[model samples]
Target chain A: MIQFRPIYVICLREFKKFFREKSRLLGTLARPVLWLFVVGNGMNSLIRPQVGFSYLQFIFPGMIGMTILFSSIFSSISIVWDREFGFMKEMLVAPISRVSIVIGKAISGTFISVAQAVIIMVLIPFLGIHLTVLQFIEVVLVSILVSFCITSLGILIAARLTSFDGFNIIMNFLVMPMLFLSGAMYPVTSLPTALRYLTHVNPLTYGIDAFKHVLLRNSAPPLGPEFPLAVDLLVVTILAFIMIILAALSFRQKE
Target chain B: MSIISVNNLTKKFKTLTAVDGVSFSVNEGEVFGFLGPNGAGKTTTINILCTLHLPTGGEASIAGYDCVKRPDEVRSSIGLIFQDTTLDTGLTAYENLKFHAYLYNLDRKLTEKRIDEMLSVVELTNRKHDLIKNFSGGMKRRLEIARGLLHYPRVLFLDEPTLGLDPQTRNTIWDFITTLRKQEKITVFMTTHYMEEAENCDRIAIMDHGKIIALDTPENLKRLVHGDTIHLVTEDNEKACAEIAKTFDILCHAENGGLFIETEKGEEFIPRLIHSLSIQVKSVNLRKPTLNDVFLKLTGRTIRDDVLSDDKEVTREFVRSHRRAQR
Candidate 1:
């Protein structure tokens, strides 16, 4: 039988480590809070109020995306750290399958990312973004799906990197473009033809679009393509699965 | 029964061959030692037996399972202590052991018992709850040994377990390992460059240039030197060497401005050499053969000579940095 105990143990250790480091927890929270209150309010005055909702309420879902993206990617950097410090050798020499290690790491990264996103979730009332109970549940579900996909992506990147500096440079290179092209800061409908195509291709675009769909379905205008809710769920679920499989394959190649 | 059987195993990395076609078998419950200088394929062989690296040729089996084909079985049957520190320093001693137990699928109740038992064995029970980052080098090594044995593996592979430790710490580490062997009856396959440490093993394979130059019990391997070695400093060293060689029909050579001879009775030869030489003997020293002598007799050089000139250390660092760019 395939044992899940190892997976659970690894995830539990990650959670313990995450909680013990107070500075890291503060850092995870600080970035999103800054973007929500300072950057959102700053940008609100410059952009025309085309969307029915205010800028702070409109960009709330984007802050959640930002939190998930940065936290998951940062958490996955531990893989490279483990390898450099020789702890990776200990985990690899264990009796369990390499796939278990990868899954364990992905799960831990997902949990941490979701936890950071929930910190933003508490700002709903403060930011004046109204949501029904059903809408709140949908928003949470989409956030989880997005977290899983992004964390899996982080694992996939981390499996191939051996140095923390290399991982940081690559994460910044990929994350900046992903966030910028994701339509998280602005509406996709207002983008030029070339930029609009880029938004369509970026997976984060679908995630943020899904978040906006669930959180502001009644209060705000649609940002981009009005795909059905089912399409967003389907795309996110498939992307998460594919990224997980890729991450597992990358780990297997190490042997 | 033999716990490990390796047949002409080989491992090559691009242009460099780290392990050549080499073979050796370790009997069950035997403390088998691979004595070699650094880069003599000791670590590579251990890595293959532990299923960490794929062999380029030949085969190896641990607990009757092929290392390459049935890696999971091989892995489950073996515990490994790497040359470098592999413990998670950020985690506490107990947490490290707990992680290993869960990975091996040990029962929850049994895992707790084993963790406590191992901590006591290594004498780290008092520090079990403390983070490993604060541990001394000796303490971390003790914890690693405890972690390695937690799963009750049939075989344990220790790669240079006491590489950089002080003499006292090295002895204590070996003491724990010896105690573990008597209590658990697990096979130990370890690699080391320290000649005196290799004496603790039941049998040792002296390796050089990726090949086993000598394999036997410590006593028998020492016997390979043939007899006690006598070092003589004479007024005429060259003449003394020729006289000893001619009269005793034994090989004698000039080393360090002195005459050296290997003979059955070093003391008996000393008197005859002084009487027969017709030259004044300044000094005579006789000593029994050691593992260092055995290495010198077989390879014509000390193990330290090879270690000093080894470029593998530089290559290892280069490889680490290179792996980063390759990704």
Candidate 2:
């Protein structure tokens, strides 16, 4: 069995690394904050809600969801840099289980990505949406799980990339497209019929829905119609497990 | 038992064998140098020893842990300075050391005390608070060395630590390395292509074509190669140099600017060499042969150029795939 030292060490190192890039920290924090502030207000002009809620109220959960999605996907870019820099070589040679390193990345990536998500999460009420303490905590836990899943997926992609150019190309081709197609920007059903499958395949879809139900819907989740809560949870959970395994397997390449 | 034992360890990339059945061992606290020309697989072997690459065949164990099966233990037992600069340019040097100290499980107070001492050792104590991005190449290299030593590993593997450094900085680094050896009992295994560098080691292994061609102390290896070396410089190009070599038993041969040959009694042989070649030599020297002569004798080739031609080379092709990694 893996012990606590590896996990603790990896996680601590990962957390420190996130703060290393001042521009990255700013970009990460500012992206979600702007979405919650200006964009949340700007969209109120064009968007009309059918439910008895303002546009800000309707868009709040999606913004929180967007924060989690972007931050989680970008977490792997640092890994790409680390690989090119040879820090990955140093990490691989450390006296720890390669599997725990992924868990540690998840810990670090999730901590920052979720921190970004929570920044937006806190700003929701300032833009006129309200939530109770229990509901807020529930949304935060879902953010943590979803962030973990997304971050591990990023690491998986990073392992195969050889250079910053390759990593940038992947970010543009894969992450950007995936984030745009997910339920973070609009309700899942609002996507064109042709794009429904895209959202269905996106783990971000269920994550967004879970937050929306707890934050905006403030009611029983529409399990069958809006989204299958159980299936989304299952997909995220499974992907997290697979990605962690793949990250461990990919780590030997550094050796 | 050997502190490090690598036997028949090999790694292949498709059809190219990077390390071919190479085997060697280092006793406790010895300054072992791995010397080779570029692309000669010195880095490949060190990577294997540090548990950074899995051998395609055979096995390597460091401090009694199997490299393939017990990589973690190998990691803990050894420290590595990679061929590429792996320092985080974003963080201050202090932060970088602290971060690594955590990975090595050094406590906060102890880590703080040691980081301070290491900074002074590298002569970067005042600069420790500055971001590594702004540091010069030599300073960066020194900081990297300090970082590698933080955990106080049993064996420290330095992969061309003085590469691209100015002579003064290289001297400083050399001094620091010797000081480290004297003060700390850490075994330092360094790789270099420079013959002068091999002379600094307690023992040296010279590799070519993925195998060690020669392994011994510099003085001992030089003893294997007899006679003094002569650098024959002439205005006339290849013809006269070729004629001179044909006229004598040239022990060492090089074709850079002129003929560099080694033979017994270089002083006595020079007059005959000039008379036979029908050329008056511009200069002649009867100097003792260095380790470079030993390498030339063993490999039957002089490493004058990095490659015969820069274009259409295997090494260039390999490095091209990682082009964006330069950033």
Candidate 3:
């Protein structure tokens, strides 16, 4: 049987460690601020959006997506660290089901990512983007769902990794490609046909689309959600379940 | 009754048979030790018994639960302190034990009581709030011991519990272990190549080449060797060696600038041999046979050969796991 106490304690350990490392909090926070101000503002004067919103406001949700993507994936690297430092064996030998470990890690990653996503929302007023109360609630809901989805995907990959030697490869090959192809920095429709197929397959694409559905509600067709709100939520929710289950399965086979 | 029983258990990697048809049983309250050099499969056998690795052949059980089939049940009933430090350095000592208690599903009240009890047992009660990174190597090990017993498991498995500690700290750790064994009623099953450390075990199984070569109490295993060992350093080493062999009819070998001989009573023999020798006897040292001598008698090698082979084995394991991660 899946034990809830193990899951709770596992998540608690991650939470305590995350807060204890002040540098880690600063590092995750600094990335999005740099992207939103330098990258977004610098590119704003060049590529003018067809819509009434400025490029800074246009990619706001994309910036939140970027924050979630990096932090969630970064959080999963704890598994590799645990393996290297011998703490993974501690949890592996525990009586709890392996599923509890995976779920605990996924939930912690979700909370940490969602927390960073909320911190990025503080930049909303400065970017001149106004949202109604209902829109803000919807945005938080989507952030939670999207964070859970991406973190589960992170856990899925981290579950199979035995060392940090593969970490750079994962960052270069997996994280970078997912960010570029997810329409996080630009519109998916503007991409070539071949790359557009990749965006449709990328789980983060739906997550960002869901973000846009709430954040950029009044925007034009191409700049708005590519698919319907229902489609985005359904895809992310389904992929979240699949990734978590697969992560737990892979974790059980960890030898 | 035997708390742990193994019947022809074996584990095979692709290129190596780490544990080969090993069988042994550990009594409920004894300190059972596996004495072996590096790469001898002591850790492999412990891993299998702890439910971390599946045995390729044979049956093993703890507390009447099969290791492979009822792993969850087996795991919950045992405590394990690995060869390397497994304590999380980022958390405080109290936090680490609390986390372990939760993982083992200890009740809230029982967790508080046990955490406090174990911390004091290891003498870390004062350092409970401090982060583990600041603690010494000995403290970390002691805390890990405390965490392992938070659930009060029946069998406490310590894989090389004192592999690289100073003599003083090792003694302190051993003291805590001995006291805790009685207080908590635990059956300790540990593995160590340190002969003196193995002397602490009520019974020891000398493992070499993935098989138990000798299994008995410390005194009994020492008796397997001939007798007391005598080391003689004389003014004329070559002549003394010849004279001792020819006159006494006892074979002696020269090693490290000293002539060594094993006899039933080295103290009595040394006085007679020193007077009979033509050359001046510089010094004579006689001591009881140690576990190292027992290992030498069995394997034709000393356990101190832990340097080159151990480094190579570690690198080989790293390369193998690196390749697996690459896939």
Candidate 4:
């Protein structure tokens, strides 16, 4: 019998490579824990919500979005490492199509990011931010979209990066700022006018808004706040597809 | 018939022309060496043959298909061991091979069988389960070899295959490569800076500054410069060089403050040269000229000093220069 070979092969290879490091697993959990247990309770004692839904409930969806965002972006760093270790050269020269290589890396990166989200999902009951049966399914769907978008961006950045260290520099520069600006840790309305405009430019903003709409009762998601849900997803998907094409084209063997 | 052929292939990056109007072909089941010092575009030529990079000018076809248009078919026929050691440290030797096998969409039963054979060839069967992070540099290199051979490619591209390994490991690796070539009847194309490695090939192409200096069997290449070589030691090298350049029509090269010359008339010319120079000769030994002499004659230098990457040789910039220096 034939097997679902390449996909399963890439997925298995990526999973072990990522989970091989224990701290990666811990880091994924630590951020969501701090937001749900420490920051949520900290904000409860600090700012009173208008609906009185408590900060623990308010930050849960944001923390999930934060986990997906950080994990997705940081996964891009593996591309830099692969280049440094010479594995990328091997991949570039493999018999498979360059498009398949891009898909393999994107699928692997998104899969890992989604898994991190799953770990946080397991802790929802302990933190008292429970998801109803319907909300649970929506969480899965949103995770997939956020995973695909961030993973695509990750591959795009990797395709352009030259040095092994520059990937970490990107994480420090763009990922942290984007995470904070996306309203992942707090409500968007509380921010200044110009900051709200900046949120419109962030992909995570749409991800979090959709997430909070389904998860947090007190937060108003304002359906497709950044752009229409279909339109924004189509834009991100198109951007991702274009990048995939570029990454494949960049694999042109040098003479 | 030629198994691989390229006609007037030229590749340029920005302002620099790394390979200019170079053309050569490898016959079926023959061992070919692309011999050149670093930055001579040896790697670039191999990359093009492996279908990793595109050629800017000219055309290269492998096994009768265009490399650029039919890359999948070309890649399927050739396995590449990059000059840089590119093994995945996170995976074990087995996993690396398995991953490559899957890349080619190998049948499960056949892949397992081939993986077993490759592990035995590299002599790493016992270490199959250990993470590649724990492998010695030589072991990692061997792992790369096995991975390249996983899909049973008809041709193997080994760029500086033994570079950076210890002599003992290098010998073992070479034996393994030679054995693989014989057993599989695979055409092996390699590039290296070492004279001996080039000599071992059935034929070699000496490349300099992105140009092919000469292409022939090692013995024939050595024959082109001289029938016999004579070594001369003298501190008055420039004067001796001038005198020899004037008196006899022969090739002379300087190395470590000594003059090596190739001429059948060494004994007859020796007395005249000594008398003309009027200097004490430290020593003189006659032997055959080598590919080193051929390279010096074509490139005019024993080394390419212009390609050194200043201070960023070990940084992420190393990768940048690895590409940028092609220009």
Best candidate (score: TM-score): 3
For each candidate in turn, give its C-alpha RMSD to the true structure in angstroms: 3.3, 3.6, 2.3, 4.0
Which is the winner by lDDT between candidate 1 and candidate 4?
1
User: Which pairs, if any, clash in model 2?
Assistant: A255-B52, A255-B53
Write down the DockQ of candidate 2. Answer: 0.41
lDDT of 2 by residue, B1-327 (tens): 468888988877556677889889988888999887777788878777876666789888888888888877788888888767888887789978887887778877899999999998888999888988899998988998998999889999999888888889888889999998998888889998777777899889888778888888888888887878888777774767567657664533556676777678878887787778766567766768787777777876655455464532576365334323321
The CAPRI category of model 4 is medium
Better of 1 and 3 by TM-score: 3
**On DockQ, who's better, 3 or 4?**
3
**TM-score of predicted model 3?**
0.95
Off by over 4 Å in 2: A1-3, A29-43, A190-194, A218-225, A228-235, A252-255, B107-110, B235-254, B267-277, B285-287, B307-313, B316-327
- Docking class for model 2 is acceptable
Clashing pairs in 4: A253-B52, A253-B53, A253-B54, A254-B53, B229-B287
DockQ of candidate 4 compared with the true complex: 0.53
Q: What lDDT tens digits, residue by residue, belong to model 3 across residues A119-214?
A: 888888899988788988888888888888888888888877767888999999999999999888888898899999999999999999889889
Candidate 1 or 4, higher TM-score? 1
Over B1-327, each residue of candidate 3 has an lDDT whose tens digit, in order, gives: 999999998877766777789999999999999998887888889988988877779999999999999998999999999988998999999999999988888899988998999889899899989999999989999999998888989999999998789999999999998898778788999999889999999999999877999999999999998989998999988889899889989888777688878899887888898889989988899989999989988987778865356664784485346434532
Model 1: per-residue Cα lDDT at residue A8? 96
Candidate 4 local lDDT, residue B151: 85
Query: In model 4, what lDDT does residue B28 have?
Result: 89
